[model samples]
Each structure stands twice: as C-alpha cells, then as structure tokens.
Target: MSASVRAVIFDVGETLLDDSTFWGSWADWLGVPRHTLAVLVGVVTTQGRDNAEALRLIKPGFDLVAERAARERAGHGESITDADLYPDARPTLGALRDAGFWVGIAGNQTERAGLLLRALELPVDAIATSDEWNVAKPDSRFFERLCTWSGHRADQIVYVGDHRDNDIIAAHSAGLHTAHIRRGPWGYQNADDPKLRATATWRINELTELPALLISSDTG
Candidate 1:
C-alpha cells in the first residue's frame, strides 16, 4: 500500500493456514507419538536445523511417500481442507482483494496445494508452490518466479509469512517488503532472533492486522 506495493503474496503454511492440527494428525497417522514428534520438531527448529533433517535423524528410514500412502490407505491422508485455514484468513484475503490489491499464495508446498485452495474457494488471484515452480523459498529463483507470476516488480510485492529464515529474511533479501506474523512453530521459535526480527518490514500479531497496516501505509 506504499503506492508501490501492487501485490501481497503470502506463505501458505502458518501464514494463511494453521498447520498444527494437520501435523498432529500426520504424526498420529505415522504411528509416532505426538509428544515425540513435537520434541523432535522443537529441538531441530530451536537449533535452526531443517525439519526434514530432524525427521531423518529420528526415523532413520523415514519415507514421506510411503507414509503418505499409508495414511491415505487409513483414509485420512487427503490434502488440507478449509478447516485448516485460520479464522482470520478468509476475511483478510477477501478484504484485500476487495481493496483492489493482487493477492497470491506462494510457498513451499506440494503441487496439489493449488487444487486444495481452489476447492476451499479462497479469494486469491494466483497460487504457486515449490513443487509447481521446482524451486522453494530462500532461493532467489523462487522469488523471481513469484515476481513474474504476480506481474509486479520485487519491491511492488509484500511477502507475509511466519518463518524467519524462509519468509522474512529470504523475501527481504529478494527485495520484497516482508511482514512477519507471530504464530506457528517457526514464528515462536524464531521470535528471539534479533537479526530475523530486524529484517522484517512489519511485524504483525495476526492476519487481521494486515488490512489496516496496508491502509495506514497508503494514507500515511
């Protein structure tokens, strides 16, 4: 809303969707105790290590594909649905679009994310994923592709996310304004990181703050 920001692209997980329940269910489906999974996630996240690496360390032979298939066979491995969206998500997105801003969802996700979001009927103009783009966040190529998809310059876009490294620092490095939302595991874990907090253009408590922040930016 700086007159230069024409689009606002959001990270899917933790940004628009509350993934704690999804991951809890997945842990149950994987036959691992929820507390155990939580401990592993916390340890790795606190150490600033990749979650995938933590999975490998814990399970030793973890196969995501097979685990997913097993869950589907158990009849609960379907993609996330509307219920996974945060309470503020739909209203915030709708309000943004109604205000004439281009809204998009772009983040690390499977190719099916687009299909799932569309099924849920979110008011987004574009949706892209790491699987679809063959690139992921913190990677310059991913930001480049996102810029192209938004049809806006890097500075004309504001990337909102919860992850300090993957969202705030990465997007800022790519020349996009960044909004760090304080929710989700990564958000809480990285909350004390001075560098990460310093890079964010704005720090928000929830999605509901976005509309007013943009509006104020425009008027100010």
Candidate 2:
C-alpha cells in the first residue's frame, strides 16, 4: 500500500459494475431494439456526449421512473443484481481492506444503489451516493463529502473510476490521487482524450491491477 494513502474511494457504474445489460434492459422497455440503442449510445459516447443528451436524442422527455415502472409491470427491471459486478471488483476490494486501507464507495448514484451494494457484501468501510449527499460528482461538495466520509486528508486518498470528467479530473482537482480504469463506453471514449488521460495518476485496464500499483507506490 502507498504510505501516503490512507483511504481509497471508488465510483460506481462502470467502475465496479458492468451496466451494459442494465441499459439494454432499459432499451427493451422503451420499445427500442437493443442493437439500435447500443449504436446510439456508442455514437454519443464516442462524441463525448452526456447520457442525458444521448437519451434526449434517442427519446425526448424520457422519464426514468415511468419507464422503470413500465418495465417492472412487464417483468424486465428485476434482472440486474450483484451479478453485474466486474469479476475483479470483489478481490481487489478485499485485498485493499485486508492490507489495512480504508476502502469506500462514493459516486453519483441513486439512494437505492447504496442499498444494492450493501446487499452484495463487498468489503467496504463506507459507502455514499449523490442521492444521499444531495450533490453529484465533478462538484466540489461531492468530493468534500467523500473526504469527510473517508475521514482522510484529500492527498491521502485515491479515487478510482471509469469516467474521465466525473472521476479523474474532478478528483484530481480536489487533490486526491486518481486512477482511470479503461472499460465501458465512457472509459473507452475518455481513454483517447489526452487531457483526460493526463489527469490520471494511474491508468489501468482492470481493477485487479490496483493493489499492486499501491504496493509499488509504497516502495517508490
């Protein structure tokens, strides 16, 4: 572990969970073909567009609550579970905790997401969400709340995620070490952006690489 780092916080979505299937489910509920939705999502992501903008382009005035209710009525939204988590997530978190680092999750997610993650029983000391904090990432308050929750100095914390702006750049600006994990549409898109890439303290392909990087930092 890095001697300077006392805590490691992570973003949700593509950081710990693979949400492609979840989005596909949403597409199905919206009566759009999966392939069509995939192409549209990919196009927008590649163009560095936000999810809300992409959704508006696909279906104007998209109501998440209504769509979710409709999907539930049709028996679709119940498919996603802890099974969506990446294979490396559990082991990496466990290793970090066992190595004596305070591990937590702080991300732009709904309140239900925190409960869902708790059900997964991941080895985390703390978990928080935008819904609970009432502030989303890229905002200074979000990072401040995360630091408060982790009980660590900003410089002694590491924030890891797949999003460039929401995770790496934002966390870096708040004085935390940042790791960019290349996966998912956002990760792939931002991976090619030199400005985003430059903000990352570490760029890794998988979560399993984190423990070793922390160890190396200790020695370095």
Top candidate, metric lDDT:
2
Per-candidate TM-scores read: 0.92, 0.91
What C-alpha lDDT does candidate 1 achieve relative to the native structure? 0.84
Question: What residue runs in model 2 are displaced by over 4 Å at the alpha carbon?
Answer: 65-80, 218-220
* Residue 207 in model 2: lDDT: 94
The models' CA-based lDDT, in order, is 0.84, 0.84
Kindly report which residue stretches of model 1 are placed more than 4 angstroms away from their true locations once superposed: 69-75, 218-220
**Residue-wise lDDT of candidate 1 within 1-220, one digit each (tens)?**
5567778899988889987776687677667887888788888888889876656665679887777677778888657787899999999999888888999998998776767877887898978889888999889889999989999999888999999988999898999988899998899777768987788888888898998788668521
Steric clashes per prediction: 0, 0
- Write model 2 residue lDDT over 1-220, tens digit each, in one string: 6879888899988989898776777677667888888888888777777775656667798876676677668766535376898999999999999988999988887776777778888899988889888999899889988888899989999999999888999999999999999998888877868977788989999999998898769622
Error (Å) of candidate 2 at residue 26 is 0.7
Worst 10 residues of 1 by lDDT: 211-220
In model 1, pairs of residues that clash are none
